[model samples]
Target: MRFQIDPNDRKPLGRTGETVPAIGIGTWRINNYSMAETALIRAIEVGMNLIDTAEMYANGEAEKLVGRVCRIIGRDRVFIVTKILPDRFSDQSKVIKALEASLRRLGTSYVDLVLIHWPRPGISIEKQIQFLEATVEAGMARFIGVSNFGVENLSRAIRATKKHEIVANQVKYSVLDKQVEKDLLGFSIENKILIQAYTPLEWGGVAKNETVISIAKKYGKTPIQVALNYLISRPMVMAIPKTERVERVEEFRGSMGWRLGAEDIEILEKI
Candidate 1:
């Protein structure tokens, strides 16, 4: 099936001036390297420009799969993001080495964004932020960000690193888990930090929900499409939904075409 992209849906990610499709593919559970490669190639052919993975995912297997996909499709068209775990920050040398390893795995000279996978417990937040700044200064990543960071932790990290700012905060946000909206979302927006939504569908809730299904019918779209549109339609937000099916890839690309109107947003918000 052919996919459609919206002209205005593409938005700038951060102060870095990089823009990605409002909706893109998330490559976490794509099991086989070859299969991941095929899915990624197909996704890009259908207009998926943003792909997210982490170094710890499958013990770097996911990064290897992403690298293979980039090799087949060429790197320039994809906005690739991979994360460094907090443990690596304890030793600054390891932080740089981990990024080099990720680059080797992805077969890219530099990643678009490198995030701290999580904030370490009882560690000096300043030092962690320093590691991130050092990585950016070393040319290992274009932009620096974080994931799974609470509001207080994110604020601390931001204050600790005066050299650079956290560009995005990847979080678990869905219609079900709206907790992020209560504080994290608002804080990130006010600080100009892009919020990247993971499991934006709540692991298939939107796909099977009666509300989402009904709304999808009204829009002539799939339940997932309606749900994802509701996400990207919001300010300072982007979603990374994982799927390997050909139809789902097309659906994700289609989700970018139209948008959730005010009423649609209200209905989704109430759910």
Candidate 2:
């Protein structure tokens, strides 16, 4: 299927009636408190208040840094989303317990969203979704979803839910990696599940692309900014790019408040 986004129309969080910046902070590889502290503050100043973290990231040390940054920035100003590791999915059900640990690390009582880190072997989609439903029921998670889920797994996971709806799916999507665009992207758009794009820059690969560079020059924007904005051009999509540098956060902010031209998008489509 071919995609043609207007690029000018700003899509919301998959019809959730919530308003947040199209880009957000990703604390995946950040382990330093001071660097994350400065970076997150700058992120908020530029309207990127969403923060994505996982208990598995740096063995929960990254959540501690995000927790500290949230404290400094005032928690209400930011939308926090954290993932629960797959090992917690089982009959014994350590899911709620794990989310609590993440909450303790995040220094918050309730997170904006909670996701199953990834689908696990021998774990029923029913069980996985049930565990996440428990988090929302306990008032600890405002929404529940999954990450690294393909279309088949995502469909099964959603069907397994009983009480709450699956809200978002965090995936590795970038200009260089368009795997999700094949089927998952279209499905998520139809189902109103927001696709939270991780690694949207392909670790700086887009910066070296001649086409992306030329488009950047036309807009007076950095290649990174063009790449990030390109991801958000899709329906029900947003980006969460991780950076340890404060200046990078400022640069990331430039990705929004503008749209890429359709002609440029056509060239990017070829890429």
Candidate 3:
């Protein structure tokens, strides 16, 4: 089925001067190449175009799968994001090499966004940011950001980048994981950086929440849809939820078109 594009579903991808869908597909532990390709193709066919993967996920097989689907669907129609592991960020040369390999596997010359997968101990955040900047300079990535970054890590990255803006910080965020809301969300919004929420479903935990279930019933939606709407309802936030089943992609699409009411949001926040 052809996916309908919801104009209201788009959000700014940090300072990149680009807008992407608030709901995206996350490829983690998708080892079966054929299944990954089919599921991602269906997702893009349904207007969920912000596709996220990592070199660390399935040892780059996920990237390969994303590449295959992007090739089939036309890459320009999607906002592609991938991460470089923390270990590779230790040195500038290693960072470049890893990204080149990622590009090769992705079958794209440039990705919309590339993120530092995590922070490493003893490695200067400034140095890693510098290498990320170099990737953009080299035209390997259009934007650079971090994943699993805290306030201090984000501050260091922003201070370190000389030319480019740290456009996003991918982190675990959901009704169940409010750690980022305590400070990271506020900080990201203040700086015009997008908060790309991974595991927005909390690995299906939100689907079983009593509050989410009741809210879902009120909206004639599933608890998962209620949980996803809650996150994307907030400004400057987007969710990348992962699933191996193509049917779940359709369920995720249901989260769009409507939003949780103010009272429902307040009730969820209390949980």
* Ten contiguous residues with the weakest lDDT in model 1: 1-10
- Give all candidate RMSDs, comma-separated: 4.2, 1.7, 4.4
**Collision pairs in model 1:** none
Which regions of candidate 1 fall more than 4 Å away from where they truly are? 1-8
**Tens digits of per-residue lDDT for model 3, 111-179:** 989999998778899998999999999999999999999999999899999998898899999987778
Q: For residues 55-155, what per-residue lDDT tens digits would candidate 2 score against the true structure?
A: 99998898888788888889998789999888888753488789889999999999998998999789888888988898888999888889999999999
Candidate 1: C-alpha RMSD to true structure equals 4.2
Error of 2 at 151 (Å): 0.8
Sorted on lDDT, best first, the list reads: 3, 2, 1
Q: Could you arrange the candidates by TM-score from highest to lowest?
A: 2, 3, 1
Q: Kindly list the per-residue Cα lDDT of model 1 for residues 1-271, writing each as its tens digit.
A: 0112223576667666767777777877665566566777888887777899989988888888888778878898788999998888878999999999999999999998899998987678888889888988988788888999999999998888777778888999876667786788778767878888999987788788888899899989888888888777777788899876666787788888777667777777777
Q: What's the distance in Å from true for residue 269, model 3?
A: 0.7
Q: Which 10 residues in a row give candidate 2 its minimum summed lDDT?
A: 6-15
